[model samples]
Target: MAMIVFYEKPGCMNNTRQKQLLAQSGHDVVALDIRAQGWSPETLRPFFHGVPVAEWFNRAAPRIKSGAVVPEAMAAAEALAEMCLDPLLIRRPLMESGGRRMAGFDEEAVNAWIGLTPVSEPISETCPRSDGMCSVPGRGN
Candidate 1:
């Protein structure tokens, strides 16, 4: 079993589900609140290595959803700066294990990196609260 440092937004449903999956798969999950982290460009950049700058953002973040922060329009340095100032802009469940890191949860990628139990239900990376029915009060997806 691997020890994964999982950075997440507290009380997020998708993050909760993702953590449950990792635990059930026999991996040790160390959950941390993403918003509480002291983020800097150097520290945050590694998690998004090789990923397009636009993909570094949390599409469900209020700023992104409101069209205020357009990931596609921002450069790498700019994106990182914005994310540092507002960690909610960073993607959910940034995970690190075995010296490798990943930003978002892709079932196939995760299963290939660290084995996962065969699941019948589909897992979604997007926040469920976006539709206004998730557990976190007053937070939109």
Candidate 2:
């Protein structure tokens, strides 16, 4: 019922699934390539409203997984600056609708914000692969 602005990394499995769920719920999904977008701290900061700085990151990112970038250790300004430098550091499926913005797809949270169709199986936030890395083309630091 809502027009969702879904920012995602193109070809990411989780993002694809998230979009499908929104569509099935009858929401209009406008999928944009997060990596390709020109983002600034001001524009990108809203998605993580009320969330801790550490949780603003895409945990599946190579830098994070490798421990090269410690989200928990960084300050809010530092985290936002790094994320703006590399969009891959930002969480997936950053969504906006009806002037409200959110990061990540917690089923209950999304459903509460804008109703999601009932699903028997749970929609997970992470990549399903054992390697823990998403198969995103051209993905790098």
Candidate 3:
């Protein structure tokens, strides 16, 4: 198993589930809050390597849902600029392992890299709360 640094938004249920799956896959996860990290375009660019700007964003983010931004219309620099202006615009689970990094969790890619397989099927149901549904920090309750 490999150790992975997983950058995520705290209080996001999906992020929690993603972490759980990673652990179940036998990965050693080190989860960190994306907001707390001091990130710049220089550091952030690698996560999106070989990935399109649109793929780097959190499609569920309110701004994106409200159609305020369209990922395809923006250039890579523009996309990075916008995300630097609001980190929340970036996708969840910026992952790093084996000196390589990527944005979001591509199941196939992860499995190939770490030899993790699906034991239980994924939860198909979406989170049944408002977009702002958040929990108290440090309390998994």
Candidate 4:
């Protein structure tokens, strides 16, 4: 079992589920509450590596779903500035293992990267996890 540092929104249902899945997969999970940790922009930014800044958001959050926060319109500086102010805007369950960090949860990617157990995230048409839309809005912006 690989040791994983998972940062998450404490009361979020989806984050809890993700942690459960990881533990069931036989990985050693160390979960932390992102809000309580008082995140810094530099530290949080790495989790989003290679991912568009827009991908780093929680869909269920009021600020984001209300159409107030749009990632594509902002640069790295703008995005990080906004995220440091509000941890809720940041992605849930940022994961780190083996010196590599990843934002959000992609079952295939997780399995491929760190060898998660065979249990795959359930497929759904209705947004179950409330994670940001696969792509940030306004890609066609």
Candidate 5:
């Protein structure tokens, strides 16, 4: 079993589900509060490797949802700066195992990296809510 360092926003449903999946798959999950962990560009940048700058953001974040922060319009450095200042802007469940790290829970990618139990229902990436709002109380970062 792998030891996974999972950085997430507290009280986030998606993050809770993701951790459950990892644990059920026999991995040891160490959950951290993403908002409380002070992050810098160098440390946070690796989670988003190969992804476009726009995709690095948490679309559910209030700033993004409210049109206060435009992910698509920012450059890589600028985006990183913004996210470092407000971690809620960073995508959910930034995961690390062994020496590798990744952002977001892409089921296929995660399965390949650390093996997830096969499921008919999709369990990663997509928000479970349909109203464009999360079920958890208090707006997601």
Candidate 6:
């Protein structure tokens, strides 16, 4: 089984579920708090390799929702700088295993990377909360 390094926001329900699915699939999950990590552009950028700059961001973040940060409008360098300053702007469950890294949880993508046990329900990247926001620590529900 692969040892996956999972960066996540504490108290995020979706993150918890993702970790559970990984474990149930027999992978070893090393969960870390994404907000606590001291991320640099070079370090964080690799997780989003081949993906669009806009996809690197967490759409549920208050800054994005409030129109303070527009992912699609920012350049790569600018986007990286912003995300490093506020990890909340980065997407949830940044996963790295076997030298390959990816942002967000796409069940099919993850299964293709590492085997996943079939599940009845669909796993989604978007927050299931009614407000379309995650209850992050120091931020309210």
| Local accuracy by lDDT, each model | 0.88, 0.89, 0.77, 0.74, 0.86, 0.90
Supply candidate 4's per-residue lDDT for 133: 33
Q: Per-residue lDDT of 1-141 in model 5, one digit per residue for the tens? A: 899999987667888888899999999999998988889999999999899999999887778888999999999999999999999888888999999999999899999999998776876565566543444866554
TM-score, each model? Answer: 0.92, 0.92, 0.84, 0.82, 0.89, 0.92
Q: Which regions of candidate 4 deviate over 4 angstroms? A: 120-141
- Tens digits of per-residue lDDT, candidate 1, 1-141, equal 899999998778888899999999999999998988999999999999899999998888889988999999999999999999999899988999998999999989999999898789968998876642235666643
The worst-scoring run of ten residues by lDDT in candidate 4 lies at 132-141
**C-alpha lDDT (0 to 100) for residue 76 of candidate 4:** 81
lDDT, candidate 6, 1-141, per-residue tens: 889999998678898889899999999999998989999999999999999999999888889988999999999999999999999899888999999999999999999999899989977787766454566657653
Lowest-scoring 10 consecutive residues by lDDT in candidate 6? 132-141
Model 4 lDDT on a 0 to 1 scale: 0.74
Clashes of 3: 0
Number of the predicted model whose lDDT against the real structure is largest: 6
In candidate 3 the C-alpha lDDT for residue 69 amounts to 85
**1 or 4, greater by lDDT:** 1
Between which residue pairs do clashes occur in model 1?
A: 129-141, 130-141
Compose the digit string of candidate 2's lDDT tens values, residues 90-109. Answer: 98879999999999999999
In angstroms, how far off is 61's CA in candidate 6?
Answer: 0.2
Query: TM-score for model 3?
Result: 0.84
**Comparison by lDDT, 1 against 3, better one:** 1
Pairs with steric clashes in candidate 4: none
Give me the overall lDDT of model 3. Answer: 0.77
Backbone clashes under 3 angstroms, per model: 2, 0, 0, 0, 0, 0
